[model samples]
Every structure is written in C-alpha cells, then in structure tokens.
Target: MILKTYRWSFVVTAVGLVLAAWYGLSAHLGIGQAIALVLILSILEISLSFDNAVVNATILERMSDFWRKIFLSVGIIVAVFGMRLIFPIVLVCVTAGLSPAEVIRLALAGGDPETPGTYGYELHEAHPTIAAFGGMFLLMLFLNFIFGEKEHHWIGPLERLLEKVGKLEYVQVIVAGAVLLIVAESFATEHGRTVLASGLAGIVTYLLVNGLGELFNVEEHLEHGEHHEEGAPARSNGPTPVARATGKAAFFLFLYLEVLDASFSFDGVIGAFAITSDPVIIAIGLGVGAMYIRSMTVHLVEEGTLAQYPYLENGALWAIGALAAILLISIEIEIPEVVTGLIGLAFIVASLISSIRYNRAHPEEAHAETAAAHS
Candidate 1:
C-alpha cells in the first residue's frame, strides 16, 4: 500500500538525482559536488517543510478526489515551477524594473554578489518583502487554527488561554496585526513601508480565501439554516466539513492551498540559494522534495494518521507559528535555517509521543476505533 501511494515520488527522485548528476558534469562542477549540493538542498527543504505536509494533509482531506488530484498534479506544477521558479523571477523583475527575459538571463548567470546581473543576488535582496508577506499569511493560519473551536488541546495551559482570548470575535486578526506592527516598528530603519504593506496584503489574502471558502461550504450553509429533512429522525445540527465539500467551496480551497504553499516555499526558495546559485539545480532538487511531500500528505490522509494521532495537527500549527515568528524576527536579525528546522521538528516529535501515550492510556478507545475500522 505504501509503495502504491508513493510510486510517483520514487520515480521523481530517480529522475531528479540523475538530472542533478548530469548537470553537475555539464556545468563542470563535477558530478560528486553537484549531487552533494542537490542532496543537501533537498534535505533542507524536506526538513523545513514537514509541517507543510501535515497542514496540507488536513486541508486535502476536506477536498474531493478530483480536487486532490488537481492539487497533486496541477498544484505541484504551480508549486515547483510557478512558486519556486517563475514567481521568483517575476518578483525580481518587478523589483529590479527588468523584463522576464532579462530576469531569466540573470538567473542563468548564477549567484555572485559582485556581479551586476546575478539572479540569486537579486532574489536574495528581495527577501524582506517576501518574508513579511509569507510570514504574515502563515501567522494568520496558525492563529486561526488555535483560536477557533477545538476539542483537543496539545499544550493544555497555553492553548486554553488562547482559546479564552479567541472567544472575542476576530481576535486572530487583532493579534496578527499587532505582531505585524511590532515587527515593522523594529525594522523601521529598513524597508518599513514596503514590509507593512506586504504584511497587510497577506492578512487580506487570508481573509478572502478563508472567508470565501467557509461561506460556500455546504456544512456552513446547512449549519446556518437549522433545517432538518421532513421524513428523517432527529440528527446533529450539522455534519463536520471534512472530505465532502464540492463545487465552489472546493475551488476556493484550491486557491487557499496554492497561496499557503507559496507562503511555505518562501523560506526554502531563499535558503536554496545559500547552497547553490544554479536555479536549474535548485528546481530539480526542491521539485523532487516537493513530490515526496505531496506523497506524504496523501499517505497521511489514506492511513488516517491525523485521526489516530489527534494532536499532530495542533503541533504542526504551532510549528508554523514558530516559523512565522522566525520569519518576522529575521527582518531585524539574521536567523539560521537550523533553528527553524529544529523548532518545527521538536513540536512534531513531541506531539507524536503525546499521541502514543494517549492511545496507550485509553486502550478501550483505541480498541474501539480499531474494531470500527475493521468493521
């Protein structure tokens, strides 16, 4: 079953490694050096993006098979080529006042800071705005998740406190905005206005995507109506919106995932340049890593991993919150990639351990769940 789920990832890995090796030889960087760089970048991307896969699985479970396929297929193309490659070029072009052709030419020139037209340098220079936008968007995601109603709490005291605060409407927005203001004030000596505007845009983008999705979702619509079928016995107020939404609701969800992906990719895309300036190599390596992540998401959904390990989603969100903080803090102080990766991994690992203990202590619940699955 695992093999069937991840066959595509395996194929992409083989092809990407071959491409990495061949390009290293062609670029005269030596095959060994080329493979090493690609491998390092890929590992870094995967390490930094495990939380992304968890969050993605949660959303993907709410979508139908068709949208899920679209996400894995069309979405992957947009993620690998669009978000990682093309969008960076577009951003550089807009920032540098150059055309797409000129941007691509510079990218091919590689990553020298002294060079007039180094692609990596231009992209690296644009990091602050990228950080502000992506950071704010991801921060909102984490805020909304923790603030909204949840039956389980991963970090009892802190989560409970946040939940109490969440009872006030739009508290997530207020907190996120406050964080943005603080970040902007500290980085005021830098691109203050640009960062503020970019951060605001991120918040608005989230509101539109999330708001529109919820508005169109059948679950929400039914919940609002308080209607019941005439011939039916009494039922719960409404069904939970999971893996059953369709039509316009799913479309907004699709858009949300793409934006969410772009937010997650900001760090990886920038960090990849520190390893190698060759955009082609970065594309192949990160692209392959992305394939594996998509596969991992599907595996989690099909195996019902999130349902089994209930706190995992909360852990992933907390990791996202930490990353958001790091991204915002990075504007004033340079942060290491290792710090971000370690923080996220720690949350996920702790959550996994907690889940295991929870299951063991409640053997009856676990056995009942297992029996229901078999039935």
Candidate 2:
C-alpha cells in the first residue's frame, strides 16, 4: 500500500540524490559530501512541509480523479520549476531592477548569497515583501477555516469564540487588515508602504481565489441539480457534496492550491541559502521534498485518515496561523526555519493526541464516522 501510494515520490528522491551527487562531484565536492548535504536539506524540507501536506489533503480529497491526475502532473511541474527555481530568479529581477536575462546571468555566475549584486543577495533583499505576502495570505486562510461554519472543534473554547466572531460581518477581513496596519506601522517602519501593499495583495489574492472557487462551486452544484428530486420540491439544507467538484470549479480549487504552495515556498527557498547558495542543489533537494509532501497528501486522502481524526485539519490550520505569525515576525526577528517547523509540528502532535482521546471517549461516533467514510 505504501509503495502504491508513494511510488513517484520514491522515484524522484532517487533521481534527485543522483543529480545532487553529480553536481557535487562536478563542483569538486566529494560525492559523499554532495549526497549528505542533499539528504540533510531534503529532511529539513519534509519536516517543514509536513503540515502543508495535511492542509493540502483537505482540499485534494474534494477534487475528482481527473483533477488529481492533473495535480500530480501539472502541479508537480509548478511546484518544482516554478516556485523552487524560477520564482526566486523572477523575484530578483523585480527587486534588483534587472532584466530576467541579467538575473539568470548572475545566477549562472554562482551568486553567493553573502555577496552583493548577486542572485541570492537580490532575492534575500526581497524577503520583507515575500514574508508579508505569504504571511498575510496564510493568515487569511487560517482565519477562514477556524471562523467558518463547522460542527467540530479541536480546541473547544478557542474555536468556539472564533466561530462566534466569524458570524459577524467580515470579521476575518477586519482582523487581517488590523494586523497588516499594525505591522506596517511598527516593525516595518522603514518599508511600511511596501509591507502594507504586499500584505494587501496577499489578502486580495486569497479573497479573489477562494471567493471565485466557492462561487464556481455553487454554480456547478446548482447546474447539476444534485439534490433535487423528480417532481419534488428542492431542498435548501441537503448535504453539501463539495467533495465531488469538477470542471471549472475544480480548476479554481487547483489554482488555489498552487497559490498556497507558492506562499509556503518562500521560507524554504530563502532558508536554503543559509546552507548553500547553489540554486540547482536547493531545487533538487526541495523538489524531492515536494514530492514526498504530495505523496503524503494522497496517502492521507486514500487512507481516510482525516475522517478518522477529525481534529487533524483544525490542527493544521492552527499551525498555519502560527506560521503566518512567525513569518511576519521574522521580518525583523530572523527566526530559524527549524524553529518554525517545530512550532507547527507541536500543534499537529497536540491535535493528534486530542483526536485519539476523542475517539476513545466516543466510540459510537467514531464508528459512525468510519462507516460514513467507507460508504
């Protein structure tokens, strides 16, 4: 079962390690050294992105089979080439006011991040804006999940308060805006305008992508007349079959996933520089890690793990909220990547423990959940 689920991830890990070895030998680094560095970074990426897999599975399970195939194909391409390699180069071009060709040339020159007027240097200089955009977007997503309608609560007291606040008009938006305003004025005083603008862009991107996805989903659902009975009145409160979306609605959901991936990539892309300035090695290591995350997402969906552990998604969202705060705070604090990953992992572990206890206490409910998932 594990092999069937993670075949591609294993293949990519092997290929990535081989390429890393080749690159290391060519650079005069021993094969062993090269493979070791790649292995270390790959582990780092997996640890950092494990929470991402859980969050991704929440959406991936709702997509149709064809769309899942598209996710494996097109999604991998974007995750590897787009965010891992090309995005950093493009970011340098924009931040350094250089042409794409110039940026590529700089990168080819072995742009050590410590050196000014180089690819890595330019990219690092753009970190503030990157953090602001990614942080706000993730914050919005976390807020939406916790605040939106839900029968389950991972942390009853806190989640209940958020849910009640969610019933108020645009509370998430208001809170997000307030956060942006405060951060822009206080911590990012020098680049306040840029920080605010980037944060606003993040918020707008979330609103546009999530709103459109939900809108198209409603349209697709109504068009199918999914719950309407023959010669019978339509029911307004029928079960929502959001998990069966396809066509344009599914396309939008796929787009949302890509954006979320991009936001999560910021830390990984930048943090890799702390180890090595070689973009190729970073791409190979992180790309392999991305495959593992994708595979984990598929495994979770196929195993019906979320159905069994109802609090898992809530935990992932809480972790996301923590990450968003860490990203924003790191604009001035320089928090370590490992620290970020550990914080998220702590939340996930707590939630898993909570879920197991819930299941033990409510055996009947757990059995009902298992039956529904299988059905």
lDDT of 2 by residue, 69-170 (tens): 888879999999999999999888887899999988887666778798877888888998999999999999988887776656888998888787887889
lDDT of 1 by residue, 1-375 (tens): 989888988888888889888988888878988888877877888899999999988887778889988988999899889987788899999878889998998887786644556888788777878999999999999998777667568899998888778779889899999988988887645878878998999999999998888778756447556444665432111124333567888889889989998998888888887778889888888888888888888888777777778678889989999999888878777788888999999999999999888889988876775554334
Locate the minimum summed-lDDT window of 10 residues in model 2.
233-242
lDDT of each: 0.83, 0.85
How many residue pairs clash in each candidate at the backbone level? 1, 0
TM-scores of the models, in the order given = 0.92, 0.94
Task: Name the regions of candidate 1 deviating beyond 4 angstroms.
Answer: 113-117, 219-243, 369-375
Which residue pairs in candidate 1 collide? 62-243
> What's the CA RMSD for each of the models?
3.8, 3.3
Model 1: what TM-score? Answer: 0.92
Give lDDT: candidate 2, residue 145.
80
